[model samples]
Target: MNQEFYHELGHVVLHIGNQRQMTDSFRRYKESKANHFMYHACVPTFMI
Candidate 1:
């Protein structure tokens, strides 16, 4: 889906090379943030 694509893109934009060095917990945390970024990036405030 588009949302998942953007979420993964978020990781590329913000995390990039840092991901390989992350712990499982931290990776999950960052993934959550990336999802949040995708939601905000794709959704408009008027639609919320």
Candidate 2:
């Protein structure tokens, strides 16, 4: 319903009137490796 979603969908669908999916998409994989890898990568702390 949003423009950004439609824009991204268009890129994935080749402007076709159907939805398309990406393969080997690690980013979307639940329990994705990025979670494990990026965990604790960023945090705010006060130190002298």
Candidate 3:
């Protein structure tokens, strides 16, 4: 599950970097967004 989800997320990241409106859609899917700790932890890397 993690592998598949990670790959899907990778695609999202690619799309975000390539498109503007796509990031809005991606952000919408994230709901409330990552918690503070998770955001901080992933900040240097992904961060939602």
Candidate 4:
């Protein structure tokens, strides 16, 4: 649940507008970035 929250938060923080008009590739890129963010947010470098 906490990871999910950070994933969405990554979207809100990194993306600032509607995503309905984005291209498929760009959407995938954004999702990838969010996933990266979620991973880092959930597990900081110091904890690794």
Candidate 5:
């Protein structure tokens, strides 16, 4: 529904883990993936 919800959903869909124990680069990478997913989730291709 909201951007925050999709962002969190991205993490779930991507199977991302806790960032507390992740390296900086790895954390950024995961965050990037989640962000990408968020965008797609927020605006589905079917709607486009």
Candidate 6:
């Protein structure tokens, strides 16, 4: 179950960087936003 959650989270994080509005410029990209959110949310990366 934990592995499943990690897999899903990775997908969400990767997709955020590909969003049309967010992909306009690399500097303004939100690619790391999801990662930061997950870290703060206590989503352990060890499981990933």
State the weakest 10-residue window (summed lDDT) of model 6. Answer: 27-36
Model 1 has how many clashing residue pairs? Answer: 0
Taken over the whole model, the C-alpha lDDT of each candidate is: 0.86, 0.38, 0.45, 0.90, 0.83, 0.52
Clashing pairs in 3: none
Candidate 4 segments whose C-alpha is farther than 4 A from its true place: 44-48
**Which model scores highest in lDDT?**
4
TM-score head-to-head 1 vs 6, winner: 1
lDDT of 4 by residue, 1-48 (tens): 988999999999998666898898999999999999999899867888
> Would you estimate the TM-scores of all the predictions?
0.70, 0.28, 0.30, 0.84, 0.76, 0.33
Measured by TM-score, how close is model 4 to the native structure? 0.84
lDDT of 6 at 46: 84
lDDT of 5 by residue, 1-48 (tens): 577898888888886567898899998888888899888878867899
Q: For candidate 6, report its TM-score.
A: 0.33
Worst 10 residues of 2 by lDDT: 35-44
TM-score of 2: 0.28
- Specify the highest-TM-score model's number: 4
Off by over 4 Å in 5: 44-46
TM-score of 5: 0.76
Give me the displacement of residue 41 in model 4, in angstroms.
0.5
Ranking by lDDT: 4, 1, 5, 6, 3, 2
Report the lDDT tens digits of candidate 2 across residue range 1-48: 344454454344433322235445532442243343333333334521
- Candidate RMSDs in Å, in order, are 2.2, 10.7, 10.5, 1.8, 2.1, 6.7
- Model 5 score (lDDT): 0.83
Model 1 residue 28 CA deviation (Å) reads: 1.1
Candidate 6 lDDT, tens digit per residue, 1-48? 654465458557555434554535652334455445555556566876
Candidate 1, 4: how far from true, in Å?
1.2
